[model samples]
Target: MTDKKQPRTPGAELPDHPKFLWDSPEPKRSYDVVIVGGGGHGLATAHYLVKNHGITNVAVVERGWLAGGNMARNTTIIRSNYLWDESAGIYEHALKLWEGLEDDLEYPILFSQRGVLNLAHTLQDVRDSRRRVEANKLNGVDAEWVDAATVKEICPLVNISADIRYPVLGATYQPRAGIAKHDYVAWGFARKAAEAGVHLIQDTEVTGFLTDGDRVTGIRTNRGDIAAGRVALAAAGHTSVLTDSLGIRVPIQSHPLQALVSELLEPVHPTVVMSNAVHVYVSQAHKGELVMGAGVDSYNGYGQRGAFHIIERQMAAAVELFPVFARAHLLRTWAGIVDVTPDASPIVGVTPYENLFLNCGWGTGGFKATPGLGEAYAHTVATGEPHPLIAPFSLDRFVTGRLVDEHGAAAVAH
Candidate 1:
């Protein structure tokens, strides 16, 4: 129930944390736009609101420290191999932005394109993986189906022998998929947005909305009521809590998702690997620690921690798959609240209120879609219309029965 203060890497020196990136400014009485949540998504949205839409009057309000929530907790796996076309459209756009994000932000994000392998254990897994590969190909996203032998060659640490339970049959390979320094990504966005004269308001909790006849005129924060021409909700897991006060029911359920890291070791994991059947995905950090994660908890709650049983099962599957990780020491474990939808897809676009926009239900894909969602959602909020890439992800999709169900497809469930 407690974590001891231990060294990040045994007998090795670690650098000091970077200097403060952005200023914490007081909220103004009014602005052109106000974005709730100061995590990666909200910061990215603010950046694009200035760069893409030429809207500089923006404020990103965060209750806690910026990027201290899921942005800091996720395992940092970035990929665009989803089975659905709508997912491909938005995520692939984000991946393209990720490719040039460092240059765009003028910061070092350490975005490594090491690659990713989604292992298939059963016959059905192989079939579904192959189908997803083809779907990704049709969407112009780089992907290929590889046999178990290829999986072993790509990651020698993997135990592909048939003697082990749920032996690896094959996998879906995406060479462009990789991981990045998540904290740096968030800071880069925040810094850029701040330089553009946008306000980064921290420690300001939004209690409710200031509405006039169903039009959201502004937000009521603990500090004061800040007026806005438009409001966008990028408040990930706690989005439902904000919308609930207005009686706008979104099809979202919040759950706790956990991830852990091992004590720093020599570089062994060269690429990211994931398994839906075994309920574990893993990669190695730039600092040489093995990073791993699991699925969401079954229950719905706002807590930022998960049950220990989930961690136990995650480690069991991880050891059987890698074998080399069996002796590694668990460095630390933490969790984040994720807002999931019934179809396992995101909700982005117009809301019942004319001046209000909604962007949530991204679940585990929020980190990967940060830039793309920000750009598209900024356009939607500025122009009062959905962006072409995010049109299919509108809130009305649930009523129209046009859900982009990645859960049923078992494609990139992480």
Candidate 2:
């Protein structure tokens, strides 16, 4: 008999969800804090605001269905192996929070800490990987520079032969890196935030801002004007749409980043794998689907779908890296709009408007930073002062020339 195993029914063993997760509330006339965008970041911010600071008069406004934006479309790979100290500080904090998030949120997020291997294919890649490993270690993150043999041992499916176009020479391994169920994480945060009296307003688009002499008083939405003492923007790629009307120019550009998944099968892949030079990252979901993604498209757009050529390149790189994925049938493919910055680092601090705080420009790294960013951002909103963790990402860095440039230093190229 053939050694191949039979395929399981698709989505048969996925996590179960509650029938009614949260209440759909109409937007109040005013709130102590109004968060634009009800995705993972927005929900997490609301959750922390109530749990940590006892500020329950919060509202999360979503233009579409809850958590249906990038939160629903990402690859879900979470890691803290960044090169810069600021990035390491924030992402490592997020990883620690992720370790206990299920207990804290009182919900199952399916966070599998199976580790991540960022492959190095060239001499420069090897050098960069080794340096990043040292940087991660200095920042108190668990990272090591593993040779080709170690990489193969960690992920046997990886192709490290010399005949390939881009052979894997080595990699930087983070033992604590992993993936999570994106939707469940979002819903868990939403449930806890809603239970604490934060309003979950869906289908309410924020059309403009209500301003009073450089201070953003509230938001003007299609539903109605909702006044707020503080407004925090967590709207991923569409942040510029609202910021432009207020004549606040943030250095961000939107692009389409796509991802796809394979048909459900028995678990074969054991850990998350990413290759920056080849521009493909792979991880097998807890439900058995092989999830894969690549860098953003060349052009800038707000579209939620990418060009066919972009998907083609991504698949080509994936198949070359893991030959077993060649026969797997593609289940679905989609994209998310990502906001990239000049320094390739997130901007998370006060804006020109006194009452408005900006937390956008995460690009492909947003989902990994959900809880960490939320805790820091919530502190910024509650007290109108930037948290110590987020103080380096202030918008003024663009002018001060102290930017945290992670253009090629990050694990993935945005």
Candidate 3:
């Protein structure tokens, strides 16, 4: 008999009621706060704005189904270890929120603390991992340096190659880092936000923003025009389209990032393993399938479908690190667009516009940072000032040369 536990066939269509549909209707043309994205960030911002700030006049406008963008297209890796204190502190807060998300939202997010190990395959990798450990500790995060022997003890299945192109040396372990249910995160936030009086309008696309001088008045959507006192641009990949309509340019690039999953098998990976040199990472899902991902496309394109070469390179690196995956059959692959910034950090807080707020350029690291981003972006929207956690990631920093470079730590995982 076929196993009932196996995942449905690839590309299987589920009943389409539009996931997490809000009960509210769109106002004719007015809202206190109009958010231009219905992804995790936008929904979470609405949640915080109502629950924390007591500001509930919000409407999250989306062009498609809620979370049909990067929020639903991430690999769900959550970690706080970083080579800089700024990122470490903010992501640590995000992890804390994730730890309590189920209780706060009264929704099952299924956050799994499987641990995340940043593997070091060379002396430079080891040194960088050590520096990240120190930086995380200084930021009051739980991070430590684990040598090769400890790594082997923790994950015996990993290849302990000495003569390989990138020899295994050591790793940095963050016990608090792991994965969470991505769709549940979006649904939970959307549910609570909608219950709190925020209108989530999917199938409603914001085509352009209505601005008067340097201040934004409202947004013009394909559905209809909506007036607002303030607007927050939480749209990840399409941030430029909205910003450009307002005659402002942000230093962001859109790239396609791909991830794949293998057929169900006996669980092997107990922790997330990241290889900087190989530019690949792997972890086993709760369903016993191996989920793996790699860097973005080499060339910029709006196409979400990536070439086979990216997955081929990822499979090769995965097999090199964990030979057991050699026999596993690939199940399916998908890609999402990422808005990458120059320093690979996010852009939060107010932009050059008076009433237009921005929370984009998260690159590939936005999923784990959703909670903190929501909190900080909500604070910025309400008070018109950057939250202390997000102060280091202001957009002007790119122009003023105060960039928070987390490249040493973010190159692999962020």
Q: Which candidate has the highest TM-score of all?
A: 2
Q: List the residue pairs that clash in candidate 1.
A: none
Q: Count clashing pairs, candidate 1.
A: 0
Q: Per-residue alpha-carbon lDDT of model 2 for 276-312, expressed as tens digits?
A: 8888999888778899888887788878765678778
Give the residue spans of candidate 2 off by over 4 A.
Answer: 1-16, 409-414
Candidate 3 ranges with C-alpha deviation above 4 Å: 1-21
Quick one: best lDDT, which candidate? Answer: 2
What is the descending TM-score order?
2, 1, 3
All candidates in order of lDDT, best leading: 2, 1, 3
Error in Å for residue 142 of model 3: 0.6
Candidate 2 C-alpha error for residue 99, in Å: 0.4
Winner of 1 and 2 under TM-score: 2
Estimate, for each residue in 1-414, the C-alpha lDDT of model 1 and write its tens digit: 112112123234433546876788878999999999999999999999999989999999999999998899888888888889998999899989888898999886777787889999999988888999999999999999999999999999999999887899999998888888898899899999999999999999999999999899999999989999999999988998999999999989998888889998887888889988787888888888899887888888878775689889989989988998999999889889889988888999999997999999989889988888989988898899999999999999889898888894333344
In terms of lDDT, which candidate is stronger, 1 or 3? 1
lDDT tens digits by residue: candidate 3, 1-414: 111122233243433445434574755579989999989899889999998899988999989889989988889999888777788878888988888887888777767787788899878888878887887888888889998788878778788778777777989998878887788799889888888888888788888988788889999988878999999999997898888877778888898898999998776677788998878899877667788998877677667775798989989998888887899999999999888888888888888889899888888899999888898889989888889999888889977999887666656558
Q: Report lDDT (CA) for all predictions.
A: 0.87, 0.89, 0.83
- Model 1 lDDT on a 0 to 1 scale: 0.87
